[model samples]
Target: MREISLDRLRTLVAIADCGSFADAARALHLAPPTISLHIADLEERFGAPLLSRKRGQVRPSAVGETLVKYARRLLAEAEQALQDVKRQVEGKGGRVRLGASTGAIANLLPRALELLALHHPGIDLQIAVLTSQETLARLKSGALDVGLVALPQQATDGLTIKRWRRDPVMAFMPAGWKCPARVTPQWLAVRPLILNDSSTRFSRLTAEWFASGGQHPVPRIQLNFTDAIRSLVAAGYGAALLPQEAVAPVQDPRIAMRPLRPALWRELGIAHSAEDIDRPTQHVLDALWSLRLR
Candidate 1:
């Protein structure tokens, strides 16, 4: 029997994640036939079917489920091996893959990246905009060098997390709306709301805060992006609860912001794999720390 190739394992994992050959091919930038052939080859070597296709949907067989679990682990290790070799030769000049939540990217990370660019010109930076959960998953899988995430209440194992900054959540109201000096949960609940989509950590945090007060603020518009939420608020659609940094870029005169009473705040932080900190990762961390101090 032939040994399974790294390429085949990678394809299997992608297929398992993406749920179909066409989708997996798109994700891996390979043709559908290529992905099918790779999976077929792997099954041939193992002498067991890896996937079951029924009614145009693909499900992993029992053997496929077991293989996928091991395949993901092997692929993660292989990627780490390449990163390790690159780090040895490149030192601080290697590429750093960083991920950030939308709120952090609006202000915090751009400033840190500018500082990193000035100090380490040789280090190439690749930035990904992702939700907090996605950022954590990428960091754990060795897919990201470092991540800027909203600090969770409980820390995950095998990760080093440092508090970067605290950003207050504010209510954005229309220009003529009469808002108190300090808005309360009761006041916010009465206003027409334009809320962040339920998927984001920010949305969950906001929801929990309101729920704590026994109020459910119904949103007329549910937005996924921070900018879109700002636009809706500015257009007089409804008020929104967002991080202070997220609304910094908007200069619309139609919207006014008021601080919430008891001051809800979100903590942003830098997180990286505890076991895999390399020169490039350290360099970026140093830059971020310097920015924090400034």
Candidate 2:
């Protein structure tokens, strides 16, 4: 059986509205013969006389009335669907998935999110906390739209990684310590240390910095979360080497920060699939790029 087209539905509805074929043809901007053919095709498909003539006026049969009622709803929904697609095309509304480290989420992503909301309020961002390796993996598997990842990552196929930010790593210590204005790796090595887990890129960066100073020290404890490491440092448990974000909290009375002498930096990069990026993802990338340090 042939499916009924919306054109035929519209003709039936117009006939019911104007109570005549001539007015429906003018209202639809179609010829009177085309309107008649449209109704004839619809009636033939349903095997029913869809129009009844009474008092020299054209009126819809019961079947035509039922179709007109449902056609109005379908037309309205089609128009709404078109509006939604247009909004997405204009970068006015869409959903984007992003993945980042806990530190990035805590110290960096909020600013980018704020910028995105300020400019593109209709863009819905779904954020996930993940390691750099996990983020890259998800990007390859089509689970993520964009990622804020630790830098110095090797080239990967089907991915585009661009340097995002470089934040100086600093020594975070309990305020009671008589810490120097600038901390050398040797000076920090001798103190009881709390460090990122050995698996993290940050841990490797700190290790290399210590090695450059000819001092290899064992951490008293290792944790994956930067926030947890800072909490331990605030408790005077041990000192930690962590990136000092530009917007990092400055009013913590118990924790003190000092720049590193050799000036080790934790670098971050934006990564996404090499395929053509959609408007929502492009907007998110633009927000992150705006936050990049000069």
Candidate 3:
């Protein structure tokens, strides 16, 4: 077995950077002979010349260039690991990977993260945007530390679920369309609709809402984004059923948002692996809970 040394790789990089062995030795505070021996050791290990000299300048050979690229990555990862360990020791914090459905991300996550940032500056949050079911699936698969998902969701094994908030679904129509103050599903079903995509739980909930009124109107357009649905409604394409939070931030004058007669609501919740709730995940969850309280 051959041994490849990081010291040799460092010396190789220094030589390439300084353009000469003597300069590299001076830069690394090593003797010139020691630097030469390091390069020689690498050449012997690989059975190839690792560098070439041209007009009194030094650079990596073709194979050496590839090795140097990998060396840089390995060194970087090692340094990062060291820093992570130090942070852990110092109680600086770690990373928490979170997943959320589109509605939750659009409405809830920014304020939740802002609260987290204020209280736990050392913790880093990694976010993935996915549908409610997808977020739960990923959470179960160990791909996510936590998820914000819409409920009345089916509870699978191995999850700790906590109720987050209830965002009422509203009717969005063209401005001055003369709809009732509280629109009924019966009234909404007769109109062409722009709805959430069929794949999402929101879309299913919307469909059920219309179904309860004994009507199923095919949507004129089915989209994944709430903002896009609002835009289409604003353009007079069709009416839409959307979460209140989705429209709360943007007050588009072209659309009139009305509450439902019975007030349809999308229940949202936080889910985590029942087996793994680390300190960072707990901290983020606490931040989210604070936002919900306010």
Q: What is the lDDT for 81 in model 3?
A: 92
lDDT-based ranking: 2, 3, 1
lDDT of each: 0.83, 0.91, 0.84
Task: Tell me which residue pairs clash in candidate 3.
Answer: none
Please, what are the lDDT tens digits per residue for candidate 1 over residues 1-294?
767899999999888888899999999999999999999899889899999988888888999999999999998999988976775466647788999876677667777778877877768889998887888899889899888887664688988888877778888899889889988888889889888888887788888888877898777878777777887888888899888864256557999899987689887888888895777788888887765620
Better of 2 and 3 by lDDT: 2
* Alpha-carbon lDDT of model 1: 0.83
Best by TM-score: 2
| Models, CA RMSD each | 15.5, 3.8, 5.6
Top candidate when judged by lDDT against the true structure: 2
TM-score: model 3 vs. ground truth: 0.72
**Backbone clash numbers for all candidates listed:** 0, 0, 0
